[model samples]
Target: METSLEEDSRTKEFDGVIFGASDQVFSRYEDSSTEVTYTYILQTAGEFGCFQRILVALTFIPNILSAFFMLGGTFMLKMQPHHCNTDWLLAIQPNLTMSQLFNLTLPRKKDGSFEECRMYTPVQWDFDSIVKYGLNDTQDCQNGWFYLSHEWSLITEFDLVCNKASERLRAYCIFVAGLFCGSLLVGTLCDRIGRYKSILLMLMFYAVFGLGAAFVPTFSIYQMFQFGIGIAIMGYTISSISLVIEWLVSSRRVHAIVLAQCFLVLGHLVLSVLSASIPHWRLLHLVGSIPVIFLVSYIWLLPESPLWLMMRGNVEKAKFLLCRAASINKRIIPPELLQKLTNEKIHQGTIMDILKSPNLRRRTLILSYVWLCIGLGYVGLSSQLHKFPINMNGSHLAFRLVEVPARLCSIISMEKLGRRKSQVLALLLGGLTCLYSAFIPEDLTSITTTLALMGQIGLSAAFTIACIFSAELFPTGLRQVGLSFVSLSYSIGVIGTLLIESLDHDHPETFMTVCGIMTTVGGLLCILLPKG
Candidate 1:
């Protein structure tokens, strides 16, 4: 049934919008209409009191756990110390020690690290003839490699170095591809299923695929698992974020977004520490999957988004969620008030709805460009964190651990500066810092590292605010689709990680400068979006 708001909307002369806006942005300001109307859940129901605080926590904590799985592939696939086994030399001389066997079979680099891919060809089996030759003639490793560590990685197990070195990077790319495919499916599907159920399903699959990857007998099987985890990771993230967003007042929206990010970074820190301490890569994968399984019980605690339930014309379901929220917050919603609740009269959204409108299309296009830029810039900066100067163990962990506060600061700036201004500030500053950091001399490592961290702070804040603002641009029905669409740019940005690494081999600054330029362009385009 249409609400009193819909009946009122019909009676009044509508102006300025035709396609649609999300419930949050679906405002009509008419010259003849001196009176105002509010039919949104936030208007009738409570926001930002104890109920919403609890809502945001429940939705975001699972999202944080999902972040742990996102980077598991990176650590699990890491290159370990390895070299040609050179077992043939043992057959020739069984008495030789391992160090002696290596010195006789492998060539040394300038600083004395053994060449991993090459071994000296043996012309004679006798020790005297071998000593006379002095290890000159070399051939690529014919025998399999012997990894230094007791634990095995994809690199060590598959011999992913040298000829197969490029293959090692494939897992990261495939993981991202899985994310893209998931984003494509989730936005529409989650909109069909309620957010609460969708998240539970995602968590279930996240655990399933993560465990499968941990014990897969072959790389092909592992790839299948990695792809599914990608879908689960992104589906849980966007849906949870959208779920929390629908519950908040505009002022609390910033906190909701950044606080979730803080959890994600915290999860990353925990994953890094776990990976470092774990003896086996498979064990690390198992560890990453376990926490998500434990978190699945949160389904009973989480509520479906009332705003979404209402948008889908499920008024009864919406009422149930609202009443539950009110009771949990120690407040009461009178039955009479809920009796007034009604769904807005709007057509269901599809991808065509986004493309068919001129104003929305323009705004979505601009936001999309910024999303792509933000994605690339963020990934580019992250790819460089290992270069940061530090004397401590787990220095990469230290670099990531500090991002929590950077995300926290966005809560203040997002409100104070407003969405558009903060985005512009972050993008501009982040781009400039990345450009400058790229040129700093290696000798000035501390100074250069500081510049990168500053870049992360700016870019991270920009990325966070950009998402909240993007959701605001679309109506509830298409908000997930819109978020998913724009976030595909982020998946596309994962390619930048590969590009930067490839370019790092020769023209190190090329990709960094490219990231700077992209972000700068994005900041300029973000100015064209309506201020949220």
Candidate 2:
């Protein structure tokens, strides 16, 4: 958070400028050296607007699939009103109806709902006159639970309700733990092998693992699939998007990244529709996995980032892609001119590079905090909303719908407000609104829903901005490294999301307040980061 003049000098030392490079590229240069030495892949590819469009298409589906990956858990873990099965009671009185059995055998709580975990009278296998007298003795469910609805869930199938309900949260935490591991693995692959190849591997893993999760017989086996899904989700995300983004100049970076981000929002909306329409959790996952087969075209169709190729010292390959891009855009660059562009190597980075470089180090630390906070607050609030009376389909759709406008606004504000301020503003506004909403009594449902929606919008916007901000802050070599750290933080945040289960029901204020504080702290940390 230091503001010393020395630190400012250190930030400025990251080569020439990046953000303002677009304007300078077109401006009257002082000499030939300026024009020759400074050129971005975007500037060279801008003539082919179709190229960007195609790249965006390549990036979009992966983002949607990533959202679907997480959404599967929402549907899979969905809870329903359930209680001890009436089979034993039915056996005692074979002629009794289902409703009659429930009334006679199940214990009712203060809420007038049948208790899910407990039942009236023990199953001593001695059905005497006590059955007709209505025995008052109560005991924990011994046989199995009866799900009120036909819609199957892990909660109903595995008896993850009542005391063991916390297992549901633990399951998701394990998934995110896998994501943390995946981010590191994918980051290394993307950094070493290349974006295109790394993503192909990820998409394959996603298809096999994600779809395979649907048929698992045991909850423990299902968890293994969830873990693999997490790994694939984050890997597909970083590799595909980073590849396309790295090829673009700063001017279109926000638009391209936001487009990729919007796909995730759209994916979430699609998930709501799928969850509501499909009725079965397994079918929903099956539908989501179908896209993986379609994305196989990416193997040959998607091109490697020319900048990445040059950075990898593949000048000839980079030249071929550039020619293909130029052909697609219908623009011509002189052979001599294109040859000189790949003259220097874009620095290859190791994990230590992020720590050793003063400018990169500061940006990484600040962005990591912001990423972690956004994940924590955003997931915490979303998870808390599950207890409310909001319609699952409508709320889920509306929640994702808002992100579209929020991200659009960020694209405009990013240019005007700059990275740090826009990001800080997003975090601050989201945090403050969440805190304010905590004070509103639950009876005021309308007001609370509005505030919750606003909070999501802000958090969504902050998350988008922070991602773009991170891209601009670090050099290409260190970009994936920074992404790895950010993903690790976010995965930890998702793990922390489990806390909402304990806190959301009893101490509502405590839940909202903790999420608010984290986002606000992220904002403060963002202020210390130098503008890119």
Candidate 3:
């Protein structure tokens, strides 16, 4: 029985060897061996490597230019003078009876002119003096000059709050809308054409519309121009993030992206200083538009992402870029390895893909909510600085300035600790700080103000982290769409600002309460985000 089993095993082994040899030969003859085809294509594609390096350098040009333009407008608007000194002093004018002031300031309706003739209400020095001295009418009051005319007062009042708030809201809405729309359009175009081309298009938009915004004669026209600026900003935001992510090594991707965000904070800080110093909205807008000229250089200098090219089945372009990268990094690419490059065909996913996969769906939902909260809460809070315990304009500018270092800290910590941990911690801290701020007694003192500011700092850090994390969570193919969708939440939040009362003295508590609640909810939602 043992001898029969041995014979059977030997016969089986011999047949297997014969079949394997025949299969190999057949595959070679049919050109059906995937390994061979992969190698052949890689060799051909590797020849054009030098061209890729040039394109990578070009990408940063447009981003920097776009940043300058977007932030410049913020600075200009911040600096523009609105409130007059006379209004506040006039309200508290001493030694004047209320009726006497009305009679002195009342304008004559006939021919719509002001007459010098004025009247004063009866006044006595004291009740006892009037009874005892039979009214001492000998007291002469010096004739006071009218420092502010009724017309000037009316114009000043119009400029003080009503007109200013309307203009600001209009500008803010236009800017946010343009940014959201532009990002979506640019993101889609990036997928269709290439990163470099999308950036060039954004730069053109920025140069034209951004500069035009600075010269708009009326507030309404300015808002329209700002909408154009928004479009350019949206285009730059989507394309720059995509292009930067594609060019860097996988290990460096997070670091590079966070660093780019740090620059965003820096842009804000720069705007703060410029806005504080310039004191004119239009000039600030002009300064913002100036950087766009730098972007024109990108038209000649930038390169398309090799990864994007590879995904599109442009093997030759990918090889050319990779080889160029290798040369720039001073690393050798093995010819044999180069010969192995081949495209893997991946299905282009629709927006539905984001919702179809459970894990992806959870991520998208959480991210979108967090993004919405960040946009609404942070921007709403920033916009409401006019209603804070501090001076509105000064606090608004200062808050922006404070974000610079906060963003730097976030960039450093995000890379060191990883995206998930940093984001969670930021949200947690922000929420707790916000909650703490609510209990602080109003009119408390410097301590309360400090705590409120600290809470703001925490919220700002969380916001910065959300932008970075959202970019990191989505895969490259759907990144722009994912970002745009999340950004749309921000615009939704901006609209919420209108519903809330923003008058500093009358409704401070209401604004603060709303901000605190929004920030807390945003932070809580942030905790559920998946580990990236």
Candidate 4:
């Protein structure tokens, strides 16, 4: 039997007793069972009322802070221009001008620039003997390197140069590895402990670990803190999105998600400004994390998802929250409706439930792969922004600004073209643009950068569309687990991007080709998903 919304009727019998639309209740009965969905109850709660707005504002502020954890590495890990530390020459000759010091102490490159990794062997001699002998003996850098730029970044402070240059890439991988581990662990944690609690816990973890990363005495400790921060971030992301979706009605979900993403983009832009203003990596890390420490106040102001409570069989708490929502929404929930909720039963979701159903299993696999591809493209492109012809800061800002229009376009496309078609189109656009850019000569910086940014627009939009689509595709019971798998796949892609980036310095074409193929294939796979 089917139940349809009827404005004229207050009660209906569809082979069994059911409520009307005005009650914001819909019930179905089969031989021995009565079923109710949270969606029906959420309608009465006033989806986007003041309560939801406040929740969104409180929950998403951390997303702005996420920008620091996510992209701050680009600025903080950068290696500035440097040459071997030749201060030894000063001890031998007190009056050697800086020019003469470099001319004798370091070897020159073909372009007449001093070699960054090599210095002339030191030999004790008077000033006139050194001038007559013309010290030409060359050897590897004997002491630490001297940075031409004053920026105090990870590279400069840690001396991650020459033999240690590869360590920088390793640190990046460690951070991404944390994201992967965190996604899987926290994804389950949120489902088990409840979204609100999970969020609060992760917020504390993120702030603590983030601040620790700034003050760590060694590179290894810093890496450990980075991993912890990554886990916290993934936990926060999964919990917040789940909470927001559970709170809002279906009609307003897209708006809420896109709005949150807008906040994230805003964070990225602000991060660019902050990076420029604060060149020291430690200070930057400290500044970025201190604000999040204050957000712990969300414990008092924010409410747990009523739907999660109901799912957990805490009917009383769910009811109280819903009643509060109704009061705030300026709506009423009848005693009968409340009674119906009390009688409702929901099974806790588990990984097995996702695999037990063929439809769900198929959707999960497809969504995971699609998310992986989107992650690969988005992260790869963003990481390469510095390689463009423009200065690093300008390119970073440009890349983030491009996301604003891309996200708006995603919203419009989701509205006009529908989710499936819009996502497919976006992915294909990104892949095809990247393919073209791959063959373009490196000297054509203008054309290459233009193409990369165009591809970013497509990938960025695809990412936003995919987030909403994945959430809707999974059943409410399995949403957390399903999204966890999807997020896990995205983490894999991000890790893949980091590994691929190491090869990028030597094989640029290979990097672009792989991204293009992954994205294009991901778009095509979406066709396999069931239509909305």
Alpha-carbon RMSD to native, per candidate: 4.8, 4.2, 13.3, 6.3
Candidate 2, position 425, lDDT:
92
lDDT of 2 at 189: 86
Cα deviation of 44, candidate 1, in Å: 6.1
List model 4 lDDT by residue over 383-497, tens digit each: 8977898888899999999999899878878777778888899999999888888999999998999999999999989889888988877656567777888899998998889
Q: How does model 1 score by TM-score?
A: 0.89
Q: Model 2 segments beyond 4 Å from truth?
A: 1-42, 122-128
Kindly list the per-residue Cα lDDT of model 3 for residues 1-532, writing each as its tens digit.
Answer: 3446654543322112111221211111113233334334423333224433344444444544455555454434432222122122234445666444443333333785433332222342453443344422221112323323222221132242332445655666677778777756775788888777887787788778776766665667766777877787767777877776566533344555555655665565555566566554556666655776666677666767765776578878877766666665555667777656567633344456566555556777777767665665665556545435656447766776666677678767765766666776766565555556657676675665576567667767777777667765665555667777777766666656545644534665565566667666766665666544
Q: Would you estimate the TM-scores of all the predictions?
A: 0.89, 0.91, 0.71, 0.91
Question: For residues 1-532, what per-residue lDDT tens digits would candidate 1 score against the true structure?
Answer: 5547653443232212322332233323211121111134454456666778877877777665676777665566766778877887777778998898888889999898999888887665577678666778888878778888776677666677877777767777888898888788888777788788888888788778976677888777787788898898888888888777767655577677888888888777878778778867777777766776677677677888776776678878878877777776767777766766656533446666667556667888888888888778777666665566652226557667667777777767765766778789888988888888778877898888788777887888888878777877665556787889988888888766676778787887876788888888888888887765
What would you estimate as the lDDT of candidate 3?
A: 0.57
How big is the positional error of residue 94 in model 1, measured in Å on the Cα after superposition? 4.1
Model 2 pairs whose backbones collide? 48-329
lDDT of 2 by residue, 1-532 (tens): 6667764543434322333543311111211232334344446656327877787787787788888887778777977888886687666668887787888888888999888889886555555664557768888888778887887667777889887887887788888888888877888889789998888888888788887877788889988888888888888888876886666654677888888889888888888888888877777778877878887888888888776787777878877887777778876667766757645665556667567566567667777778888888887776765756677777777788888999889987887777778988999989988888879998888888888889999999998887777766655556787787777888877777676656656776886787888888889888787664
lDDT of each: 0.73, 0.76, 0.57, 0.80
TM-score of 2: 0.91
